[model samples]
Target: MEANYVSKTAKSMQLHRRAKQVLPAGVSYFIRYFKPYPFYVDWAKGSKIRDVDGNVYTDYWMGHYTHILGHSPSRIVKAVKEQIEHGTHYGVCHELEIALAEQVVKMVPSAEMVRFSNSGTEAAMYATRLARSYTGKNKIVKFEGGWHGGYDALHLAVKPPFELLESNGITDGALRDTIVAPFNNLQETKKRINDKEIAAVIVEPVIGAGGCIPAEKEFLKGLRELCHEKDAVLIFDEIITGFRLAPGGGQQYYGVIPDITILGKILGGGFPIGGVTGRRDIMERMDPLLYERPKFSFQGGTFTANPATLTAGLEMLRNLEDGRVINNLNRHGRRVYRGLEAVFERKKVDAVVNCVGSLFQVHFTREKVRDVNAAYRADKEKLAKYHSALMDNSVFFLPAKNGAISSAHSEEDLEKLILETERFVGESGY
Candidate 1:
């Protein structure tokens, strides 16, 4: 399989060789690096991406799950193009920012106010500061499998060996007040936070990077109640689940609202963006005029709230506001979940498929995956092989990462995915 991939991706291989001289690991992001080097995309449209080698594959990664409307949707492209002619970056306040923020407040149940940033990592960092400022506490609690971006306070305990630091540069003091708890197990989570001076409890409604496992509805309800009892802010890091789950995001879909919501990916309409939105009282801490320097939790960036990004974002939100597109995508997600499970079951493969709305990941294990530990215990090598097999057959999955379903994906595309999975199962001894 590796030899076959190398043969077909000669152009990509050559590009990778050149890239290694400039970019570390031949990729900008480490996650983009896969075995036998990753393919460099020449262009993408709708549900497919054409690599430099001219091999077109149905893309399930969807630009880190950002392109919910699929690549370069005509409406967003037109809006951005029109905005670009006016100005790309103002570095100052603009009506487009106000329009997008108002739209977010209208759609998100808890979003009484909104703030924007360039990426989810920046939003996570700012949100953490706001929570600490609002509550006057330093301690933050996060779930083991939850991923709230690369912010130091919430970056630990993301994967197995939960006690180890996720990265090297993080200082001990940076994580001193951050507590790690078990995901989906409210009792265990409560025990970890017992009687602590907590500022906030952050979580990913559906764990994305750690594993595509959905938090139990009951567990989320428990967290909401627990946060109230402890006077801690409840933040839902909805970077992966925000617009993709529903127009109102995971909070609306699960009927459990958080005090603050962190959003990214689909919110940008394929552009780079991150947002922090929630109750007005909590969000207002970022306002310098309302509070002095000591009380203020500052949040701003040079590229934040730029015209071009807001133009694209507003259009995307407007399309998803009615929930028709999101509902259809959810329906497709359910179908894919069932189809994939049936394929594995028919082949007597001991695999578990974890799915929530439009996001899904296949774990090569008999154990039911409820948390990150169970996910990592599965056959990692087998999962990689499965993803590679899918890629070879013109289906892309980013190799063991979660796969997303977009509105642009057709019935034929889904059918092809299932048939390819069946073929992979039949051919492989696993």
Candidate 2:
């Protein structure tokens, strides 16, 4: 198996070597890099991807969970094609922006008003700023492993060893105002927020990049109550959870509506997009008509409402209105979750698979993974080996990242993944 992978992927290996000279770590995204090297994709369609070496695999990464409808779904492709023919960038107001925004407002419970940005990172940064402007507060409270974006203010404590900065070049001042709290621990979180002038408390309903550990229902409810008491804005960073869990995202699933919600990933119909949505009064702070107002929070981008992205997003949302697609994908995800549990039980492997909606992760531990600290306690080396083994068997899932199921996935795809997982466990001596 190893020899075949190496022989078939010779071209990909050559490309990786060439890419090293130009791209950092031979990959554009840091997470895309792995031990041997990341596969160079030639093309992808539906639920499968083909590498440069003509090696095809069932893809679960699904464009970093952005391709909820799967790679180049016919509807999105047609919409983008028609939109580009008209014009790629208008740099002015277009009807498509209103179309998408209206759809968001109708779907998401708290999205009375909407603002679009280019990426989740940008949207999150703006959400934080808006919170500060609304409450006249300076500090922000975020969960220990909650990953909002790459921005300086909300970038700390995404992973363990919470005392240190997650990345270098972050100034001391940037860290001063950001408070990190223990996820799923109400007492600890309340203590951290006590006496602090918190403008916003941003949290992921399910920790996406950190791990697939879900926030407990009681915990989320407690945070909502705390925010109301403290006069702080509750920001739900639903970049991964939005539209995937349900049409209304995590707030709908948990029945806890936040003051602000940051949405991205699946919302763009396989394009780069992010959105900040909330109450009308709060979002109106960015209204250009309020330019003379001292409380106005400036929010604009070069491609804020580009017609192409909005058109694609609108089409995607239109297709999702029936809710059948999301239901099917989630059903498959539950099947995968059960299959994983069965595999561990059969193989007598001490592992836990955390699953929520259409997302799942394999953690090599017997302990329940409720937070980042518990997730980190898993056997890292064994988990890495399991990921590698799955890849060798022509199944693609990002190492240490959650796997997303799409509506494009078929029963055969699920069966193959289960079989491959069984093989991996049996052969890995776990």
Candidate with top TM-score is 1
- lDDT score, residue 393, model 1? 92
Candidate 1 residues 1-430, lDDT tens each? 9999999999999999999999999899999999899999989999999999999999999999998888889999998999999988988778988899999999999899999999999999999999999999999998887888888887898888987788999999999999999999999988888888899999999999977999999999999999999999999999999987889999999999999999998888888999999999999898989999999999998899888889999999999999999999999999999999999998899998898888999999999999999999999999999999999999999987999999999999999999999999999965
**How far does residue 354 in candidate 1 sit from its true spot (Å)?**
1.2
Model 2 vs. true fold: TM: 0.98
**Which residue runs of candidate 1 sit more than 4 Å off their true CA positions?**
none
Backbone clash count for every predicted candidate, in the order shown: 0, 0
Worst 10 residues of 2 by lDDT: 1-10
List of clashing residue pairs for candidate 1: none
Best by lDDT: 1
Candidate 1 positional error at 266, Å: 0.7
